[model samples]
Target chain A: MKLTRRKRNMALITMTPLVDVMMILLVFFMVTSTYLDLDMMPMVQSESEGVAAPADPAPTLLIRITASGEARLRGQPLTAQSLASALASQPRARVLILPSGGANVQALVSAIETATKAGAENLRVVRLEAAE
Target chain B: MKLKRRTQPPPQETIVSLIDVIFFLLVFFMLVGRMDATAPFEVSPPVSAAGESLPKGGTTIAVAENGALALDGEAIERPALLAHIADLLSKKPGLFVRINAHGEARLTNLLPLVTALERAGVGDVVLVITPNPA
Candidate 1:
C-alpha cells in the first residue's frame, strides 16, 4: 500500500458592499445634525447708532437688571420703591425699559409694573441692533 | 504508490451581515436624534445687536416668568391674544407687535405666539432683549 498526498484551495472575500453601506450612513448623519451657530446673538453697543436713531430720542427710561437680580435705571441702582419714585418724575407717555443681559425676569416684571403704575402710557422694550 | 487531489469548501461571505449591522446603527441614531426640542419656557434672553431698536407706536406683549401672557401688563389668555392683536390692528392698520419674552421661556412657546402676531396683521415684530451688564 502507498500513501496519498493532496493540496487544499484558499478562499477570498470582498468588502465593496460593506464600504458602500457605511458611506450612505455617514451622509445621512451629516445632513440631519443641527449645527448651532454660537455667534448668532448680535453684540449691543453702549452708544446709539446715527442711521437708525430716532429724532426725538423718545425720552427712553432705561432699566438694567444684573444676573444677581439687582435693578438699576440709567446706571443709578434703585429698589422697586425708588424705581417707581424716579419714574414718577418722567413723562410716562413714552418710556423705554432696556434691561441688561442676564437680568432677572421677576425684577424686569416688577420694573414694568412699577412703570405702569407710575402712569407710563407707551412702554417700549428696547432691542438695539448688533453693532457693525 | 497512488496520489489523490482534494477539493476545498467555498469561503463564507459576510457582506449581508455587515450591511445589517450598518442599518441597525443608522436606526439607533435616528431614534435617538434630537428633534426641535428647545429649553423650557423660562429663559431670559441675552441682548443681541441683531435686534433692531423697536420702531415707534406698536402694541407690546409681555411673557412673564410664570408663563403668564400680558398685553401692556394686563393678563391675557392665549386664545384671546389673537383677538386682542386683531382689535388693536383694526385701530391702527400698521400696528407693530413687540414680544418681550423672558430668557427662560421656551422657543417652542414663542414661535406660536409669533405666528399669532402674524395672523393678526402685525407688520413689524420686534424681540426685546436685555444687554449683558458690565
Candidate 2:
C-alpha cells in the first residue's frame, strides 16, 4: 500500500512539451496566411439605357481623389464651393468622378454633393478597370 | 533508526510527439495561407462591358491614399508626373500605365492625375486587382 501511494505521487505533470507544440503551431499560421492589403469597393452596374446613349459633346468634368484624401479637379486645387461653381457653369450635362485606387468614400460623397448642388444633370463615377 | 533514500530515474517524457504535432500544424498553415499579393493596392478600376485581361509587365503607377503618385514605386511630384510620362514615352513607346490605388484614397485625388496622364499621351492605362480567392 505504501508503494502504490508512492507511485501515484510520482506521476509527472510537465507542461514544457505542450507549450513548445503550441508555439510552433502559432508561428506556422502566421507565415502561411496570405497578406492582402486592399479592400474591394462596392460597384453598381450602369443601367442599360444609360449605356446606349452616345457620347455628348459637352465637356465632361473629371474629379479625382487620391489615397491620402486630397481632392483635385482637372489638375487644379478647388474648394467645395469653387468646384460647385465650376459645375454650375457647365452645361449641366455629364460629370465624371474618377477616384484613385484607394480613394476615400467620404470624399467621393462630398464631391457628388457638390456636383449635384451645382446642377449637374448626369453624374457618373468611373473607375479604371484592371486589364486582364 | 536512520532511513536511507533510494534514487529514482527522472520521469520519461519525450518531445517527439510534441514536435510531430507542431510540424503537422506548420504544414497545414503553409498550405491554407495562400493569398493574393496584389490585393492590398486598393484600386477598384472601372470594368467595361467589353473588358478583357491584359498581359502583365506593363508600366505601373502607384497612387497612394495621400494622393501621392509613384511610378514603379518611385515617388514623383504631381507637376512632374506628366513630364515624366512624356519622357518615358520617348524611351518606350506604347507603355501602359497601371494604377494601384489604395481603398481609403479619395476619388478627388485620382481624377486630375488621370487627366494629366491622358494629356501627357498615356494611351493605355490599366488598373490592378486581385481576383477573389474562394
Candidate 3:
C-alpha cells in the first residue's frame, strides 16, 4: 500500500489581541498618571558635592520669615529690589534664612526665590533647634 | 439573450498598521509618564522659580497641609517612617530622599523632618517644588 502526503497551509496569526492590550495600557497610563512640572531644592547634599567654604568668612546677611508669611531683612520687608541692593555691596555675602517655625513652606520657598533672584551665591537655611 | 455575471474580489483589511500605531502609543506613554505612587492625601508642593530640575529615582515622602505624612504613598507615623527610612539607608548608604510637602505645611512640620532625615544618615535629600504656581 502506498501512503500519500498532504500539503500544509501557512497559518495566519491575528494581531487584534495585541492591539487591544496596548490600547488598554495606553489608556490606563493617561488616566492614572499625573503630569506635574516638578522641581527640587536641595535640603541636604554630600560633603563632597558642596562648594568649599571661603578661607576668609564672608559677611552674613540674615533674612527672617515671619509667622504671617512675610520675609523681613533688617527690619524692612524683604523684596527682590531690597535684596539686590543689599547684595550689590557684598556680592559674596552669605545669605542666611532663618524661618520661624510658624511660617509656612511657601514663605521659605519665596525667601529662597528672592535670594536667588538677587544673585546670592552663598545661601544657607538656618534651622532653630530647641535648647535642651 | 443571456448576460454573463462578473464577481469582483473582496478587499483585504490589513491589521498590521493598526498594531504598529498602538504599539508606538503604548511605548510613548510608558516612556513619558512616571509610575510613582501618588499620596493618598492632597499635597501641593511649594512654588519656587529658583529650584533646579528634580532628578528621578528617590524615595518620596509626602506631607499634607495638616502635617500628616505618607511615605511612598503609604500613610505612616513619624517614628515608623524614620525607622523605615533608616533601614533603607542601612542597606543603601547613598539613598536619595524627596520631600513633597504641601505649600501650606508649617515649617515646624518640614524643618524638623529634614533634620531628622539628616540625622538618619540620608545624605541626599531634596524638597520638591513647582515652578508654575498654577
> Can you give the DockQ of every candidate in the order shown?
0.06, 0.10, 0.77
Question: For candidate 3 chain B, which ten residues in a row score worst on lDDT?
Answer: B125-134
lDDT of 1 by residue, B25-134 (tens): 77776665644323334435434333234444456677766567777657788879778788878888767665777756533345456655654567567666653222
The runs of at least 3 residues in candidate 2 whose Cα sits more than 4 Å from the true structure, single-residue gaps closed, are: A1-132, B1-54
| TM, every model | 0.34, 0.38, 0.91
Better of 1 and 2 by lDDT: 2
Q: Could you give candidate 2's per-residue lDDT for residues B21-108 as a string of tens digits?
A: 7777777776655433343334453322222344446566677666676766567777676778899988977766766665456555
CAPRI-wise, candidate 2 is incorrect
Consecutive 10-residue window with the lowest summed lDDT within model 1 chain A: A37-46
lDDT string, candidate 2, A1-132, tens digits = 455543456667676867676776678578657554322222222122235656557677887766654667878764657667776677554778776656564555445555655566677777564322
True contacts kept of each: 0.05, 0.17, 0.85
State the DockQ, from 0 to 1, for candidate 1: 0.06
- On DockQ, the leading prediction is 3
User: Docking quality tier of candidate 3?
Assistant: medium
Per-candidate local distance difference test? 0.57, 0.59, 0.90
Report the poorest 10 consecutive residues by lDDT, candidate 3 chain A.
A123-132
Residue-wise C-alpha lDDT for candidate 1, range A1-132, written one tens digit per residue: 887866666666667766786868866875877633211111122222234755576556666656565657767775555656666676443666665544554455555555655566666554333221
> Which CAPRI level is candidate 1?
incorrect
